[model samples]
Target: MDRSLDQLRRRLLIHCTPSQAHTAAEIATAHDTGLVVTGASADTIAHRLREKGFDGPILCDADRYSGPRRVDGGRGIRPAWCRRQQELGLVPLTDSGYLEPDNWNALRSILRVAALQRRPVIAMLPLAARWFAESHAVDDLARELDSYGVAVAVAIEHASDPFSVQYVVRHFLRLLRTAQVPVLLLRSDVAALGALCHGAFAAATGTTSSLRHIYPLTSKGIPRAAFPAVFIRHLLSYHRLDTCETVFARTPETSHFWLCDCVVCGGTTPDRLHDSDDQYSVALRHSLHAQLLLHDEIFRHTDTPDQRASAWHEACSHALFVHRQVAEHVPDWRTPAHLKSWHTVTDDPLRGRAGIPAQPTQRSVLFERPAEKWSAHERRGV
Candidate 1:
C-alpha cells in the first residue's frame, strides 16, 4: 500500500457525466486533479475523452445513484463491457451497487470480480451502513477490504441533518484510518471540506444543483430546477434564492460584505453570477476554484497530525464565524440546515470519543492569521 494514500491531506475530484465531458475537460485543464465519470454513459464518456485527447487520470464508477434496488439489478454490464472500457485506456471500476449492511454478499461479489480481473475497485459504502455498524464491525470491514486493496468511496444516502452528517463522516474517517487505503467521499458537496479536514484522500461533487444535492436512494435521477447561486467560500455553503432578482434584492449589502476572491467571480458582485449566459458552467467553475483553494489552505499545515488538527480546528472556527455572519447579514439567504449541526458536532472536545456530551457554544476566535502562525491553542484535542 502506498503510505501517501493512507495519509490524506487535501485532494478534490470532480464528478461528471458524458453530457458534461467538455466542461470536465475544461476544468481538468485548470485544476490539478482527476475526474470521476459516473452514470450509464461511462463508455460514452471514455470514448469522448479519448477523442478529445484528455490524458488525465480517470476513475470510472458504475453506479449512478443509491436506491432500494440496485441500478442494474445487482448485475452491472457484462465482463465484455468492462473489457471494452479498459481497452479505451480508462480504469474500469467494479459496480459495487448501493452498499448496505444486509447486502455484503452483493458487495463481496463485486470485489471478487474486480480482484479476478486484476483491477483496483471503487467501493461505495452507504451512510446507513456506517451509522448502524458498531466500531468493531467497521474495523473488521475495513480490515477485510484491505486484502482487495480497493479505494473506498462513501455514498451519503441519508444526511439531511448536520449533526448526523458530522457523526457519520467522523465514523467513516475512523473506519478508513484502519483500512489504510485511499478513500473518496462521493457527492459530498460542501461537506467535502469537512472530509478533507478529517483526512480523507479525496472528495467529489457535481456541476449542477441536482448533482450537488444529496437525495434519497433512487433508481431514476430526479430533475430539479436550476437557479443562479453563489458558493460562499468562507462559510462553505451555497446561497440560492428564487431568482437573480431575488438574490440581488436580498444580498447587495451582504455581497459587498463577503466578496468572493475566486478567479471565476473575483471583483464581481454575487448577483452577477446569474448574468452569465451559461450559469451552470459559471457556478461549477466557481465551485471548482473554491474547492481547490480550500484544499490548498488545508494542505499547507499538514506536516504532522498535531499540526493538521490545529489547521482543521482553525477551519472549523472560521466556518462557525461565517455561519454566524450569514445568519446576521443574510437572514433571507438560505443555508443548509445541517451546517449548524456540523459546526456543533465537530467543535465538541470529545468528538469521536465515547459518551459525547451536550454540544457547547464554540468560543474560539475565527482563524485570521497566516497558517504558520497557528499554535497549540488551535489544536482543540483533535
Candidate 2:
C-alpha cells in the first residue's frame, strides 16, 4: 500500500462493479483517484487497474452481512477476500448488508480479522440497510470506534423496503453524539437524496445513483450529460452542514464506458443491451464517466472556500441539463409502466400539486419521540 495505517481519514468510496473497474481505473488514473471495489471478484479488476496505472486507493469490499462467522465461516468468500486484498495492496471497506439476529457478532468477527491484518477500516455500517436496528454488539463497538476516533459512515440504502427508517435515524443520532466521526448517509435516489438534504438529517451526506445503471437521463440540461449538478448543490447546501459527495453516472466522453464505443451502447444511438447481462456494461460505463467528472470536481471545488461558494451553482445547472436529456427508464429495478417523467402541476385544489413546483421549502424537524432507551443502553454497557 502507498499509504500507511497512521491515521483514519474521511474516504470517498466509488463502488466499482467488476465490469466497470477498468474504466473506473482509467478515470481514477487520469484524476489520480482510487476505487472502492466490492466483493472478492472486485480485486481481479483492481489488479488490472494497477497494470494500467491507477494512482488512487483501492478498498476491497467486506460485505459480511451475516456477521463474522456462518455455520461454515471458513468457507465464506469474505475472509479469503480480505487476505487477497492485502496481497494486492488494497484497503478494506466494511458494511453489514446482511440482516441477521446477531449482526454484532458478524461485525466483531470481521473487525477481529481486520485488526489482525492491521487493515485500517475507513468507515462502517453497524445497522441494516434502510433501518437502524442494530445487532447485539453494535452499540458497544460504536463506543470502541468512538474512543479510537475512526471515521464512520452509515449506509441508508433503501428505506422504501418493507422496513423502517426510524431505527436507522435513531442509531445515527447516537453516532452523532458519541462519536466525533464524519457520518455519510448514502441515498442515491433523487427524491430520497432530496429528502435527506432537506431536513435536519443533513449533518453529513453522501449519495449514489442508478443513472448509469439501467436508466440514464439525457444530458440536455445537466452537466457531463447526467444528473443536474444542482442535485449535488442542493445536497451540499440543504444542510448548514458542509462536505458533500456524490456518485454520478455519465461521462463527458461518448455515452459508452470501458472505452468501448459500441454503437448501440453509450451514444445517442446505442445498441440494445440485454437485461439478462448482470454486468450492465453500458450503465457501468456511463456511471464511471459521470463519477470521474464529479470526483475531480469535488476534490478541486469542495476543498476550496471560494470555489465551493462560487462554482456550486454553475455545477448544478450543468447536472440539471444532463438529467433532462437522459432516459427515465429503470428496467427490472422499477415496476413496469412506471411514470418518472417531469410533470408540470397547476394550482388545482382537489388533488395535490404532484409536480415539481418552485424549489421545495425546508421540511419541519421532528424529535425522537421514542422513549429514551439510551440510558438503559448506557447502563448495560457500563
Reference-based lDDT, each prediction: 0.56, 0.36
Query: What digit string (tens of lDDT, one per residue) describes model 2 on residues 18-126?
Result: 6656655554454344555554476777787778767577755443432223122222224455566667766544433442334545545544543444444444453
- In model 1, what is the error at residue 39, expressed in angstroms? 1.6
lDDT of 1 at 126: 42
- Name the lDDT value of residue 295 in candidate 1: 60
Candidate 2, superposed: residue stretches over 4 Å from native: 1-11, 62-80, 94-102, 119-126, 129-141, 147-288, 291-299, 302-382
What would the per-residue lDDT of candidate 1 be over residues 1-382, giving only the tens digit for each residue?
4433322225577777667766676666555556777766777786778788776666666654453444532453246556766787655555555554546565566555655663544555544434434667767667767777777676656534322455564567576568776767766576666666666677776665545544565555554555656565555666652443454455444444345445555544444666566666666666666666666555653555444444555555565665565556545655555555455545433334232111123322222222232223212111
Clashes per prediction? 0, 37
| Candidate 1: regions farther than 4 A off | 1-10, 64-78, 124-133, 159-164, 217-226, 241-257, 332-337, 347-382
